[model samples]
Target: MTSPLPFLVVQTALYNRLKNDATLSSLATGVYDFVPETALYPYIHIGEAIDTPDNSHDRYGGQTVATLHVWDQYKGFKRVLQIGSRVQALLDHQPLTITGLTHIVTRYEFGQPLTDPEPPGDIRHLVLRYRIVTEQTP
Candidate 1:
């Protein structure tokens, strides 16, 4: 079976970085394996992660795909966009030290923003996906 340690490591790394960030800290932030119920706008939810085996004949590794959700109840996308930009700056192409894994690289895969009314409410959703490559350490 595949180990979840890499995913957990990536999640922890992102949470550690963003939680301390001046911008994101002001808003409602959640770094978890599942979304939580809360009454907070301009929220940052770091949820959902998947890992796929990316190994070769002489190496063991995996490519992790993770999603970051930026949500706002505000009428415009400006706030979400700004926050998203900050997130990108903090994480995109940045090197991360993940426990139990030797990090290779972390970069943005893509980001899609939209007007979402899911959960039966009006909100702006900016979803960013990232790819983190890693190999087993020791």
Candidate 2:
């Protein structure tokens, strides 16, 4: 099994990046790994994560699959999409800095926006997928 450190690193990287982004931080009030109790709407969440071995020629490494979700009830998909674009620009094919691991590469896998059904009106969910490659670093 691949180590989970890479996954956590990627998750933290996402959180930090989004939280500090002038656009996303201002648009979304909350950025979290796990949805917080009493969390307000129009927040960003680090959703699912999975890791796999990327060993070749005796180079041990991990490739992590990360998912990010953007939730907004702002009466339109525009806000959610704008935030999603910022996230994509930050991560897509962009190298990330992962503590305790050497970040090889991070790239966008796919992303889409869906109309949320739970809250009923003007709710949008942006689902994003990213692939992160990491090798152990002391």
Candidate 3:
């Protein structure tokens, strides 16, 4: 049997978790893989992912490192930081329901804050990352 794509599964699970959370829904406009050009000021965007194999003699496993971006047009980092904290609280060392795979653990890797230096420099960006480890069933 062919093993499932760990990165895609992990990403989907993460998206579902964030999208359905009432707290996140109230904080951000929406969770999106592709953000609309006219999307509102605050939103969560599922960004890049990296998958690496972690196979054993008897089981197939993988590690997926994913990045989530929080964008806001607030005056300072307060808004974005609050949202990022919620994201971390939701996923850090938490359990994820990955389809067709056994979830080992999902750990928060790091968070970075950035500024969009374009014309109006009021845009705030927070980059959050997580590492998800999964293994296939026997």
After TM-score superposition, the amount by which residue 129's alpha carbon in candidate 3 deviates from its true location, in angstroms, is 0.7
| Clashes per candidate (backbone, < 3 Å) | 0, 0, 0
Cα lDDT for residue 85, candidate 1: 90
- State which candidate has the highest lDDT: 3
How do all models score by TM-score? 0.85, 0.88, 0.95
List the global CA lDDT of all models: 0.80, 0.82, 0.90
**Candidate 1 error regions (>4 Å):** 1-5, 27-35, 118-121
User: Which run of 10 residues does model 1 get worst, by summed lDDT?
Assistant: 26-35
Q: In candidate 3, which residue ranges exceed 4 Å CA deviation?
A: none
Worst 10 residues of 2 by lDDT: 1-10
> Candidate 3 local accuracy as lDDT?
0.90
lDDT per residue as tens, model 2, 1-138: 344457767788877877887877777878888787888878889999889988766557889999899998787789888888888888887767778788888888898989867645577899999988888764
User: Which regions of candidate 2 fall more than 4 Å away from where they truly are?
Assistant: 1-5, 119-121
Better of 1 and 3 by lDDT: 3
In candidate 2, position 127 carries an lDDT of 97
TM-score for predicted model 2 compared with the true structure: 0.88
The TM-score leader among the candidates is: 3
